[model samples]
Target chain A: MMDPQRLKYTREHEWVGLESPGVALIGITDYAQDQLGDVVYLALPEPGGRVVRLQKFGEVESVKSVSDLFSPVNGEVLAVNQALRDHPELVNQDPLGEGWLLRVRLANATELNTLMSKAEYERFLHREGG
Target chain B: MPELLRTSLYDAHKKLGAKMVDFHGWEMPLHYPAGILAEHRAVRNACGLFDVSHMGRIALRGQGAAALLDLLFTGEIDDLPLGKARYGFLCNEKGGIIDDVVVLSLAPQAFLLVCNAASWDRALGWVQQWSPRFEPVEIVPGREETAMIALQGPAAAERLETLAPGLSTSLPPFAVTSEVVAGLLVTVARTGYTGEDGFEFILGAKEGPDLWRALLKEGAAPCGLGARDTLRLEAGFRLHGQDMDEDTTPLEAALGRFVRMEKVFVGVEALREQKRAGLSRRLVGFTLEGHDIPRAGYAVRAEGQEIGRVTSGTFSPTLQRGIGLAYAPPRHAEPGTRIIVDIRGRDAPGKVVALPFYRRKQGESSLASL
Candidate 1:
């Protein structure tokens, strides 16, 4: 439940952390993992693959159903969380820390301003009745 | 929107924080706060209770009851002893399965038929349409007034004994008995859909919540349909609409034992013709090599050619592996044959294995009796 004030959020329940200039670390939000239940498998995008904002970049499969992982920012994948291959439950136990999905070199840093802050995202969730 | 029906224990499920979902037209619990995995493990290791009130219960009375049931079901109905239950299928004239049901012989000319929830109305109609053939019979549908609950697992008998004295010892497998629990009359049948030793209670709808609370007080974990599906799949039990349907025969569904061929029934001629002509496709159990979950409607292939399709698939909590049932061509249906299940878009390697991916140890006497 790491609702870091600095991290940006999306309506689709993804989070983007500005790791460095023009680079970002992205993972599904704590709310997303809580809704998905125990994650059994993760299909991640390979490094050097292009990812478009608001598009499906990967998938998270629970025992009940599969949910698409939407990208929050346009970028090229620099690295994926390889450790998730052996232990998918990391997404459920530590979704914000060890469960980060990808590190991407951003295509447009200006897009970060359009994403919601922690307070705004919390309000959005409230508005949506979640 | 049409109104959704709720079971008598609906408020109890909500109080327990169960994740509710629409099952057919009934609002039911898909899983509880402990989740599907824990619920599944509880049933396999200890005991679990389920609200199965949505399933249809029909009561037949009068002298024509036995004859009517005999002509409708595939099994021998006339010879069933009192206080015993038998599992069988209702098939159409084309030998296709209509529904799989359990018939409990309550008395000399009285019986109870339990059917799947989704097929309740259709099954009732089928029985009603054929009732004229055996006149002077009373067909009473009991969905509105009755509720059903199942207590299943290896420890089910022990847990049940705490509530009803002499129930575990006196009631053998497939036996039914009437008892008074908490001042409410209940019909306890030693039968279950899950491949475990358990009892299904048919009681008044008004008394369902109290019984549910009583069972929980006796240390039975509350389970949902999520665990129910996986448990039944692990036991190699066929789901009516998935494994067999209006177009699939009992032989193709690997349920030949339940069908008594010597009897004259609705679909006897068609089944006899199928036996003479040989089955084109057969249902087979399979196991994946890894964690890739094979799901229903996945394409099954052999030697790079599509041979069949998966009917039911799930990650078995007991086995800790992916297991499924598929309908394959006769050549590809034998055990030990290698096959590929197209999961999502990737080809997952698997092997055709024997039915029942899980079996209780010998001398366990509970599930082994099934």
Candidate 2:
């Protein structure tokens, strides 16, 4: 499946989609979830918490291993996916949509320019030989 | 590091879109397209096939074979009837476990050892060191020429019965027998790692891929070692070097019953002394509260003190809770005793529980007419 072209990506395989004028959504990429095997739990920051660009904000633990989730841009957490607390499998089934990790009020919206597009992210995954 | 070795079923696993990982230097499948959770459930519900050729298989033959085994093993081997299998451990002189293994009596003078691949080379060294005393015993390392497959689940018998007629109902638990299926001669043992009624097949290496494909045609879901780990964890089986190491005695590893105290074996004196003195720390089962997954090396606390560390832990697929085994101080080792696990710095509430985390209803999980 194609990653939505409108989304921006991180080298660590997180995606950021601008939801509104300075608000964006975040979640792991499909490749990230597939590599993790089976999502069992996620430890995400609560709303109102500040996150820095390229900083670890959460973790995704699967049946196989745990991976850190990094912030794609500096922002204040607007909301976290409460449903994922009990149903983390959503990250494996629909990572880009229903499995979105958080909504952030972007503090440095210019940071989006530094991120990769859908095609660039696909090329990065290939370069990594995945 | 050395290049990883591949089993006979490697191509078959790749054909199923399996994710291969390095397991003790062997390139083994970690999971298939269904993932570990689904594969674990499939084995608990229907049937799951596994390529377990990575386990070390060494055959001992000749007059001195049984005696050689009797002295090396913690349990009595002479009383084991022909075609029967016995579980025991290879222990050092200090009573520490080297490896837990299964010995199958192929004939009056022949025995087969199914051991952990991680322990194969070291365990073989110990055997050779003692072989000269038991002359005429042939230590044949057959792992290179053989392949093992495990078919587990409640439907294992019925599904396997379709291919090998009359085999399911006839083979009893812990029994080993020979059978011919799909033109391959396989030694079928009614033994398994999962807490289910199942069978393990040892056959020629060249025929492993064919047998795997044939089982798939019979509706067995191909499983990988990832599911195998969860299944064994729920079953309360100890993984070599993870759950127990050379420093952990059989008694401390919750394997006291496997060590026959009266047996004249290498580690008997130390075990006898430990039995007299007492266990300082006991390997026990514990369950954690919601979303608290206790992983290996996590601290286990009791009475506001860090008393031990978890050895094997996981989120139980069947029990739907966090379950694990850890070495616990005696006061906190009893069932229902309150304990806490330090999960990455968060102290999560837990309790000492009896193994295994999941138990099949009578006559379930195996083909014992279920």
Candidate that scores best on lDDT: 2
Tell me model 2's lDDT, rounded to 2 decimals.
0.89
Score residue B292 of candidate 1 by CA lDDT.
Answer: 80
DockQ of all predictions against the true structure, Cα-based: 0.46, 0.76
Residue range B1-370, candidate 1, lDDT tens digits: 6888999999999999998888989999988878788888888889999999999888999888899999999988878999988889899999999899999999999999999998888889989989997888999999869889999988988887768877789988888989875456899998886777788999999999989999998899999998899888988888988898989999999888889999999998999999999999999999998778888899999989999998998877788778899999889988999999998888899999988787766433333353
Best DockQ goes to which candidate?
A: 2
Q: What is the lDDT of residue A15 in candidate 2?
A: 95
Write the residue-wise lDDT of candidate 2 on A48-115 in tens digits. Answer: 99998989998888886777889999999999999898889999999999999999999978889899
lDDT of 2 by residue, B271-324 (tens): 999989999989899998877788898999988999999888888888887889
Interface RMSD values, listed in order for every candidate: 1.6, 0.9
Q: What local lDDT does model 2 show for residue B80? A: 92
